[model samples]
Target: MGKNTWIALFAVVSTLGACAQNDIRPTVRISPPIAPESTAMAEATVTMPPSGYLDYCMRNPAECPSSARDATHPEPMTPLRWAELDRVNTMVNASVRYVTDASLYSRQEYWTYPNGRGDCEDYVLAKRKMLLDRGWRAETLLIGVALDLEGLRHAVLIAATDKGDFVLDNQLEQVVAWQETGYTWEKRQTAANPNIWVALTGDAAAPEPFEAPATQPILVANAHGAESKPEVGTAAPAHTIRQDAEHAESTPALFASTTDAILTIPTPKPRPLLTARPVSADTFSLSYTTETPVIDTAERGGAINGAS
Candidate 1:
C-alpha cells in the first residue's frame, strides 16, 4: 500500500475505536416535568389528623379502629350514602347522652366511643365506628377539633363527601354542612394517610389568641336618675368576667371595668337662708282722701210747692 493510504487507514481505525468506547459508557435518564395542576391537587389533598386522636391511637393501638390506618381513599359519596350518613349521625346523637370525660373517666380529656353516656369526643368516635362499619372508607371519616359556635373546644366527626364536607356534632342533631357549623377548624386526619395529620390552612390555623372584647364604660346612675361621672384621679376597680367554659377552665379570668367599681360621691345639700331684714316705711307708702255732699232742701221745697 502507498504511505498516504496507510496513514488514512490508521486514522479511520482510531476514530472507529474511539466511537465504540463512547458507546459503552452508561446512559443518563431524565424525569418528566410535573404538571402544575397535579402539584396543586396534591397540595390541596394533603391533610393532618388531630393530635389528640394520634395520641389515643398510639397509647391504645389495639383499640384504634382499622379505619385510622387504612390507606385506601374513599370513593365520592352518593345520595344513598348521604342518607345513610344522616341516619347514622342521628341515631348515635340520640342514643348517647352528653357527659363530661372528667365525670365518667376521672380524667379531663379522654377520647372514646361511649356506650350510653359520653362527651363530645365519645360522640365523634361512636359515629365514626358506625359509618366505618357501614362500608364508609376510614379516610373519608375524619375526627377533628374545632371551636364551636360558643367558641368552645369541641370534637366532631367530619365526613368528606362528594357533595362537600359535612359535620356531625353532638350539640346539634342535624347533620349540617361543615361550613355551616360555625366552627374554627384546627387540625384533621389526612385523607391519604390516617396515621399522619396536617394543620388546616386558612380558618384551621391556630386560632388567634383570645382577646377579651373591649368593654364600654358604664354610667353610674343615682336615685334621682342622674348619671354621675367617675372622678378623674380615682382608679376603676377591676371586674373579672368568666369566659366560656373551655376558656374559663384553660385560661385566667378576663378582667374588665364595670360601673359597680365606680366610687359614689354624695351631692352636697344647699344651706337654708338665715338672715331676715325688716322692710322700711318708704318701701310701702299709700295715699287716701274722704269727702261728703250736703243735701239741697230749698230745691226739694220748691218742687213740692209746684206739685201742690
Candidate 2:
C-alpha cells in the first residue's frame, strides 16, 4: 500500500527472477541402447559335400534327392518345436554309444543311421531321421561339419529356424544355438538341396597386410646359447640384398657410409685359433737345437760312467 512497501515487493520479485535465471543443473547424456548379439551365420561360396554323405545318399535315395526344393526357408520356431528338438537331441545322445568308423566297421569313415552303437556321423543321421519322422521338413534340418574345440573333425545336425540356427550334437545333450557352440563351422547342407553343401563364413576376416618393422632390432647371441635384441637404428631404405658376387662386394662397402645407414652389418669374424704348424725335418732339428741342450755321444757316456 505504501511507496516503500511497493518498492520492496518489486525488489523481491526481481531478485527471485534473477535467481531462477542463474540456476544451472547438470545435463545428463543418455547413450543409445546396445544392440542384441547376432545369432545367425552366413553362407559363403558353395563347395563339395563330404564323401561319406555321398555314400549314404547313394544307399538311401529317398532321403537325398538331386532336385532342389522351391519352398526352402527357415522354419518358424515355436515353443512346441523347441521342446521337440530338445527331446530328440537328448534321446539320441543317450541311446547311441560312440564308436569310431575304424573300430566299428574297419573303415576310415562312414555315415548311416545308428542302431545301438555308431560314430558321430551315424548319430547325426539318426537324429535327422527321427526329426523327419516327427513331421519336420528336410530343408529345416541340415547336416553340418565343424572342427571341435580340440580342432578335430566333428558332425552335428543343424536346425534352421526363424529365431536362429541351433545345433543338435552327439557330444552334447542340450540343443544349443550354433553361435555358442565354440566350433569353427566348415560346411553344411544347403537349403535348396540336402545333398549339396555350402561353406560357412563365420566371423572370418581378411588377414591384415604385413608391415615391416619400424626399427630393426639387432639380435646379439650370448655364450650360453641365449640371444637378446639390442636397441638399434631404423630400418634401411627398400633395397633388395644383392646376391651376386660383384653387387654383394660393392653394396656392403657402400652401406656403412651411406646417409640412410643399413641397420645390420656382417661382423668380421676373428681368425681361427692359431694351430701348430706342421714342421719339416730341418725346422724340427733347428727348433730342438735352439730350445734343448745338444751333447756329443762320447761326452754323454763319460758323464754316465762318472755318475755310476
Candidate 3:
C-alpha cells in the first residue's frame, strides 16, 4: 500500500475512534411476524450503540480494494458498495409483512384490507411500490411470478442493487436469494406498468422484443413524478370494457395511493344521466358490492335481528 492507501486507512480509523463497546445497550426482543393477528413464533431485538454506525466505518475501509487499478476498476462493483446494498436489502425485507393471508383472494386486486387475506401477488406488488419510493430504478425492478417450493403461486420483487440481484419477498423479512426464495420462474414484468408486463410465457429474455432500443428521450419529471399534475376528475380515459382472466401465476399485492395522482376519486356529486357501459380489460374496475341488512342497530349499542 502507498500514501493514498495510508490516507484511506487513517480516515477509516478516525471514523471508528468513537465507537466504545461499553456504550452499547442490550438488544430488544421482538417476536416473529404473524398475520394481522395471531400467535407469535420467534423473537429478536436491536439495541442502541454509542456512535451507532461508527464501528462499521472502521470495519469497512474507505479505500478501494488493493486489487483495483483505479476508482472504477471493478466492472460491476467495488467490494464496499456491494456489501452496503446487500445489508440494506436484507434489513428492509427482514420481516415479511402483509395485511392478510394469500389464498382467500384470487387476484392481486381482489380483497380490501382485512385480517389475513390476499394472495401472493398482492405481497410482491406492495413491497415493490415501497422500494420504488426509496429511489430504486423503475426499469431495473422486475416482479417475478412463480411457484415456490411448496408448489403454490408466489410473487417476489427482483431488485438489481449494487450487490447484484437482491430479492425483497413476503415469505421472510430478510432479503434472500432469488433461488433460495424457492420461486420457480414463471413471468417477469416491468414494475411501474402492468399493461406491458406479461410476455409470451417462455420466450428469450430481451428487455424489449427483437427490436432496437428506442431513441426517445425519457423525461425524469413525467417519468418518475418529478412535477405534480394539478388537474383531475377526467384524466383516465373513460372506456367500458373488462377482462375475466385469472391465470395461476404469482403477482404482488397491487394498490397505488391515488390521493396525489390525477385519477379521479369518488366525490359527493350526483350521477350524470347517461347510458350504462361495461369497462374494458385495458381499464380497471372500482367495483363494490353491498348485501341486504342482516341485523339492525339502533343508536344505542343494541342489535336486533328478525328471528333473534
Please say which candidate is ahead in lDDT: 1 or 2. 2
Q: Write the per-residue lDDT of candidate 1 for residues 1-308, one digit (tens) a residue.
A: 11111111100000000000001112232211311110001112333333334334422333332222333334355666767777877787778777766577555455555768777777787788778778987767876666666566677787765445667777765566666666666555555444444455423222121121132112111222121222333333432221122211121122122212222222221111111111221111111111111111111111111000
The TM-scores, one per candidate, come to: 0.47, 0.53, 0.36
Candidate 3 stretches with Cα past 4 Å from truth are 1-119, 161-164, 190-194, 198-256, 263-308
How far residue 227's Cα lies from its native spot in candidate 2, in Å, is: 61
TM-score, candidate number 3 = 0.36
Candidate 3 lDDT tens digits, 1-308: 11111111111100111111121123242322321111101111211111101111111111101111121111133344334334444443343334323234321233121123333343444455555555544544555555555665455566543333445555544555454544555545432332123332422222221121121111111111112122223332221111112311233343332221122122222111111111221221121111111111112211111100
lDDT of each: 0.42, 0.49, 0.29
Model 1: lDDT of residue 181: 61
Model 1 ranges with Cα > 4 A deviation: 1-51, 63-74, 202-308
Q: How many pairs of residues collide in each model?
A: 7, 0, 29
Q: What is the lDDT of candidate 1?
A: 0.42
True lDDT of residue 46, candidate 1: 30
Worst 10 residues of 3 by lDDT: 5-14
